[model samples]
Target chain A: DVKVTQSSRYLVKRTGEKVFLECVQDMDHENMFWYRQDPGLGLRLIYFSYDVKMKEKGDIPEGYSVSREKKERFSLILESASTNQTSMYLCASSRPLAGAASSSNEKLFFGSGTQLSVL
Target chain B: AQKVTQAQTEISVVEKEDVTLDCVYGTRDTTYYLFWYKQPPSGELVFLIRRNSFDEQNEISGRYSWNFQKSTSSFNFTITASQVVDSAVYFCALRNTGGFKTIFGAGTRLFVKA
Candidate 1:
């Protein structure tokens, strides 16, 4: 079975503090993503990386940044955490779909998630 | 623009009852994918099903089923004989064939009472 491990299950940080949420997938997937979940907004993508050192901004990337220094590790960084940035953060990984014949079948395997609370 | 709407915010049902979760989507791309994900109290999003735009077949897996209709731009999920373990927040999502981003709906919380 594929395992996507998140560094922390629960975290609490003060406002203006720098925070890091780490994720590592054992499946060697080429695609990794960061998403934040809120009450009424659902899961909004913050950033994604298709390859090491490559990143793409998602729909809600304004308050977040991501780093993919290694193939298996993707980290979401909050430069200055704020109260509004508090939410459940999820990390997911998937096989590359660009050249696949049936790309629609490519689904993501997610980590347990990190519940971050900024006070 | 691509969007997914799950209008039913929450639903409650007794055990053995049936329930349906509604989903509506809007997108400009001719080729797209629709998905259903279940998030229980564990907080991990589990992929339930994925359907392409061309396929309108209604699928059933055990007591869980999905209905996809391109003409109505809706992909609905139904649970037959609801159980207490079926309680979760279900999200409907959409992704274009050429893009990497998958937009998700607000989600529907289902509670099954024993």
Candidate 2:
């Protein structure tokens, strides 16, 4: 079965501390995304990578960054965690490439989210 | 800019009752994709369905159904007999042609009570 795996299901960190959230996908998909979910606000995209070393900022990229060093792994990095940054973070991957078979790429497979609490 | 709207923030219904979630989207592009996703209390988004602009057919998968009306720019989801396990936050999403990213609507939280 196709799967996306998140390293931590729950994380608690102090304010001003650096944090890392890791994600890996076994499907060999070409596109990966990171999003933060808050009550009522839904899931807001933070960043996405189409290929290794290629990244693009999404709607709310502030206070967050991403790294895609390898095809299967995508990581989200917070330079300094703040109380407001506490939210459920989700990781997703799309098959093939971004533009190929637009219909096929439209569907995304997501990983179980990471709930981060900034103290 | 592409945008998706899920007007219902929360809905409560008794078990075995039918429920529908409304969704409207706006985009200048002629070709786009619409999707519905289910997020349970566990917080992971599960892809429910995907419909493209060229296909206007309403789809039914068992007790779950979707109405896609291109003229009105609406894609609504309905559950024939909702159960407690059906309780979840449903998100409507849009992806414009040639775009790699998707825009998600503010999810509708559904609570099914027995």
Candidate 3:
């Protein structure tokens, strides 16, 4: 079974505080993503890493930063937490199918998610 | 740019009734992937189905079926005889041609009444 684990399930932080959300996947997938999910906005990507030390900005990357030092772990960082930045954070991993194989990159394994509240 | 849309924000249905969640996508690439994911109250995402662009054929698993139309760029999911346990937030996602990242819709919340 594939397992994606988040460092925290629920977190509360004060405004202007720096926060870190950690994610780890045991599936050894090459691609890792960070997304924030809001009530009506659904899931919007913040950042993604194709390989170790390689990162790309997604739709909602402002006020957020990501670190992928290792292939199995990806970390999402909030430089200065604010009320507007509070949302459910999700992490997912998948293998790129292009040039690889058809069956390898079909689905993504997602983490349980971490709900963050900023006051 | 690629985008996904789920027009219905919320839907309610009686138990054992049938309901369909609509999803439309915008992508210029001819080859792509569409997916449906269920997020229950527990907040864990469960992958329900995935269909590639080449395979537009409909699929049925138990009471769940999906209709994929390339011309209209729609992938709709229908749940028949919906039970209380079937209530959740359903999201439609599109995987781009390169298969690097996936874009998700706003999601439709389903409520099943007993």
Candidate 4:
């Protein structure tokens, strides 16, 4: 079984506060991702990391950033939290499939998620 | 860029009834991957199935089955004799071979009534 641990299950922050959501995975997955889930909107990718210290912006990367200091840990940073930014945050990691194209086997193992509320 | 669209916003089914969730995707890459995920009220995503571009075979697992059509670019999920436990918001997703970008549909919320 793979475990993707999130730092907090629920968090409340004031508007304009900088927020950090941490994620760690026991599996040695080469790919890590951050997503924000909202009602009707589904899940939107915020950022992802394929290796330590490497990060790529997803579709909705505006006003958000990420850091992957260690292979097992990836962090999503909200530079200035706003009411619109409050949503359920998800973290996922996946081990690349051997003998195939890297993204061909994207069976993602996901964290429990962090529900952030910016008032 | 890859995009996924789940047209049905919500579906309600009585116990023992079968329901199908539709997913349509748009992508230029010939070798992309499609996926279905179930998000329960607990707010965690459960990976259901993954299909690559080359595999067009329909798959069945217990009461859950998936229909992947390359021509329509549609990956639909069906639940047979759905139970109350199967109620959740289902999402359709797409990821290309290049990685970095995994797009998701708006999701269809399912409610199974007993």
Candidate 5:
């Protein structure tokens, strides 16, 4: 089974504080993504990394950043936490590479998610 | 820009009954992919189905079936004889042709009663 693990299942942070959400995949997938899930807005992409040290901004990348120092791990960073930024963070990994189907059709394996609340 | 839409926000069905969830998408490109995922109460997302644009043939797997209509730009999922275990939030997604980006719909919550 493909496993995607998130560092924290729940977290609370104060405004102006820095936060890091971590995700690790055991399948050695080359593509990783970060998304925030809200009640009505669904999952909006924050950032994605297709290779180590390479990252691309998604639709909602204004308030978030990411780091990928290794192939199996991807981290999402919030420069300064805000109440509006409090939401469920999901991390996903896909195998072979991005967009190309060297293996499967690049379906994402998502983490259980981390629900963050900023006070 | 490509987008996916799930018109139904909530659906209710009794055990052993049938239910259908509707999904519509917008894009001129014919080389895209569509997907459906389920998120149960445990909060873990599960992959349900994936349909590429070129393959328009409908699919049936046990009690779950999907109808893909290219002309209407719609892909609908139906569950025959729904069980209580089928209750969850269903999301429709679309992947662009040349990008790793996958856009998801707002999702529909399905409630299967005993």
Candidate 6:
């Protein structure tokens, strides 16, 4: 079974602090994603990386950035944490699909998630 | 813009009762994927099922089932003989063909009381 490991299960940080959330996947998946889950907003994509040193901005990437220096590790960085940045952060990885004809079985494997609280 | 809507915010039912969660999506792409994920108290989103655009067949696995209706743009999930362990927040998601980003709905929280 594929395993996605998150560095922290619960994190607390004060405003203006720099926060780093690390995630590693054992499966050699080509795609990695970061999402923040809120009460009513569901899961909003923060950033995604398809390859080493390559990242793409998701729907909500204003105060967040990502770094993927190696194939197994992906990191999400909060430049300066604020109260609004407090949320449950989830990391997921998946294998790349070819195209429309690709099988639907290619699903995402998620980590246990890091619940970050900004004070 | 692709969007997924899970209209049912929350549902509570006694054990052994059946419950259905509704999902509706909007997308212009001819080929897309729909998915249902379960987020238990552990906070990890577990992939439940995934269906592509061309397949409209309803599927049943154990006590869980999914109904896919392309004409209505809906993919609903049902759990028969619910148990306390089945309580969780269910999310419906949509991803266009070859797209990297997946859009998720607000989610429906199901509570099964013993």
- Find the candidate with the highest lDDT and give its number: 6
- Chain B TM-score, structure 2: 0.98
lDDT winner, 4 or 6: 6
Q: For model 1, state the Cα shift of residue B3 in Å.
A: 0.6
Residue A108 alpha-carbon offset, candidate 3, angstroms? 1.4
| Model number 4 iRMSD | 1.6
Off by over 4 Å in 6: A98-105
Ranking by DockQ: 4, 1, 2, 6, 5, 3
Candidate 1 versus truth, CA RMSD in Å, comes to: 1.4
Model 4 clashing residue pairs (backbone):
none
Question: Candidate 6: TM-score?
Answer: 0.96
Candidate 2 lDDT over B6-83, as tens digits, reads: 989999999999999999999999988899999888777899999989999999999999999999999999999999
Which lDDT tens digits does candidate 6 get at residues A72-111? 9999999999999999999999987666343234688899
Q: Which tens-of-lDDT digit does each residue in A21-114 have in candidate 2?
A: 9999998888899999888787889999988999999999999989999999999999999999999999999865444664334588899999
* Docking model 5 quality class: medium
Return the lDDT, model 5, position A114.
96
Q: How many residue pairs clash in each candidate?
A: 0, 0, 0, 0, 0, 0
Model 4 C-alpha lDDT per residue in residues A1-119, reported as the tens digit of each score:
77999999999999999999999999998899999998888889889888999998888999999999899999999999999998999999887778666655668888999999999
For every candidate, how close is chain A to the native chain A in TM-score? 0.94, 0.93, 0.93, 0.96, 0.92, 0.93
* Local accuracy of candidate 1 as per-residue lDDT tens digits, A4-71: 99999999999999999999999988889999999999999999988899999998898788999999
Model 1 Cα lDDT, one tens digit per residue, B82-113: 99999999999998886678889999999999
CAPRI-style grade of the A/B interface in model 2: medium
Could you give me the TM-score of model 5 versus the true structure? 0.96
| Tens digits of per-residue lDDT for model 5, B1-114 | 888899898999899999999999998676888999999987778898988888999999999999999999999999999999999999999986666888999999999999
> How far out, in Å, is residue A15 in model 5?
0.6
B14-111 per-residue lDDT for model 4 (tens digits): 99999999999999888988899998888788999989999999999999999999999899999999999999999999988867567889999999
Tell me the lDDT of model 3 at A38: 95
lDDT (Cα atoms) of all candidates against the true structure: 0.92, 0.91, 0.91, 0.91, 0.90, 0.93
DockQ for each candidate? 0.62, 0.62, 0.55, 0.69, 0.56, 0.60
The Cα RMSD of model 2 versus the native structure comes to 1.7
